[model samples]
Every structure is written in structure tokens, then in C-alpha cells.
Target: MKLNIQQETAQDFNAVFELNKLAFGQENEPKLVELLRKSSAFIPELSLVAWFQNQIVGHILFTKIKIVNNENDTESLALAPMAVLPEFQQKGIGGQLVNSGIEEAKELGYKSIIVLGHEHYYPKFGFEPAEKWNIKSPYDVPANVFMALELTPNGLENTSGLVVYPKEFDTV
Candidate 1:
């Protein structure tokens, strides 16, 4: 099936929420997505939707996140809360959304992306442990679960820190 990836617009708000609920099945993901939308850090173009027959079937969001280093300096962008409708699971829709998002990140010149997701699933997109880059997440998760990808080589070379999502995330 051909998948169409487009920048999410206001009209897609309700559909994106419904899709997230169905895809993650009533997790904090849906709530976080809503919060991210209102957060100042949201990049409109980075919030994407996958549509088919005029229905949104997938959604991906990349919000600005910070990583605080030992020197107390912070780095940004911790990719999270990506979802594909339940019926669309295991199909390539999720992959397409991820790839599209990554491409968007590249075009915007964002150096790296961090994700706490399935160990097996993300590596196919070139994500490896953020720790390898001296990057860490605020939450405690398995090493393999907290992954990072450099859109360009050495993207994280000077980035050694604790990844912090926006303040809105703290409230969720």
C-alpha cells in the first residue's frame, strides 16, 4: 500500500488523537501528544501524519528535549511517542512515518534524535544507544531502549548529557 506522509495541520488534530489512542491503547502517549502540541517547543513541520483515503492512520512527533551534561550544559531533541494505528501495526506505516520524520530532521539541520523504544525495531533506522554518545535519558530504561541517531556523523560527539523533555512532559 502506498503511504502519504504530510505535515500535520489543524484539521488533523482529532484524527491524530484517535489514532494515538488506538495505536498505543490508552497509554500516556496520547496525553503527551496533546501536551506537546501546546508546548512552545513543537515544530509544526516535525509533527507528521500518515494519511490514506483521507483518514489519518499514523502520527509521529519530535519535540525539543534537552540533555544536561556533567558540566551542566544541555543538548536537545529526544524523539518519543511515535504511533501507528493498531490495525496498521507490523505494516510499513510506522517505518514510513519514522523515515519521513528523520528526513525532516535532516533537512532542518537537527544533528541528532533520541528515542526510548524497542531495541530491535529502531536499529533498522540507524539508532544506537545514546550512552554510546555519552547521552542519557532522565528516566531509567534499559540501555538498548534509550537510543540515538546522528543525522550527520559525530552529531553527538560533544553532546554528553541527560536528555530532558520539555517542562510540559514533566506535568504528564
Candidate 2:
């Protein structure tokens, strides 16, 4: 399928919200997206959507996050919640969103991206266990699912600490 993946605009807000709600079968993720859009960590360029013909079929977001240790606090991007229309799932729309988002984050100079997602799916895009870099998640999750991807060589090198997510994520 030919997809038009682009940065989300103000007019796409409600469509994006409904996309997440329907994709995830809940309200928390959609709510989180709204809250993140208003938070300091929000990056307009990283909130992307996939348009199939004219309607939104997929959505992805990457927001600023921090890795804090006693010594240093490093900035990174977090891929919190990615979703595609339920009918559109497993047809590569979600993968297209991921690949597009990665390129966008790299172009914008983000070093690495953190994600808490499926252990198997993300690895195809080069994501690995965050434990590979000593990074820890704020919640209790299996090491394999909480993954990180270095957009550049050694992007997470020497970056280790607890990921500090925006307070908006607590709503999830």
C-alpha cells in the first residue's frame, strides 16, 4: 500500500486520538498522547501519522526523555505508544511508521530512542534490550520488552540510568 507518512498537524488531533483509542482498545494511550502534546517534552516534529489515501491509518510519537544518574543526565527520545487502525494491523503500516519516525528522530539529532514494546517486533528495526546499556525502566517489565535503539553508533554508550518519562505517561 502507498502511504503518506508525515508530521501530524493541528487538524489531525482528533483523528490521531481516535486512531490510538481504536488500535489499543482503551482510552489511556489516546489520553496520554493529548497530555504529551501539551507537555514540555513534546516534539512537534516527532508526532507522525500515516495516511492511507485520505484517512489516518497509523500513528507514532517520540518525545523527549531523560536518563538520570548521580553523575549525568542524558537526553533521549521515547517511543511510547505506536498504533495503527485495527483493520490495518499486521499489514506493515506500523512498520512504516517506525521506520519513518526513526529517520525523523535521527535527522533532528536525537541519539537514541527508548521503547517498552514487544520483545520480538522491535528487534527487526534494530531495537535491543535497554539492559544492554544498563538503562532501567521506571516500571517493572521484562528486560526484553523494554528496549532501546541507538540511532547513531554508540548512541547510548555510557548512557545509563532510570528513564524519566514525562508525568503525562503516568496516565497510561
Q: Each candidate's root-mean-square deviation in Å?
A: 1.5, 0.6
lDDT for each residue of candidate 2 in 30-121, tens digit (9 for 90 to 100): 99999999999999999999999989999999999999998999999999789999999989999999999999999999999999999989
Q: How does candidate 2 fare on TM-score?
A: 0.98
Candidate 2 residue pairs in backbone clash:
none
Number of the top-ranking candidate, with lDDT as the measure: 2
The CA lDDT of each predicted structure is: 0.85, 0.95
User: What tens-digit string does per-residue lDDT give for candidate 1 at 9-67?
Assistant: 99998888888888877857788888888988899989999987777889999988777
Q: Give stretches of model 1 more than 4 Å off.
A: 70-74
Worst 10 residues of 2 by lDDT: 163-172
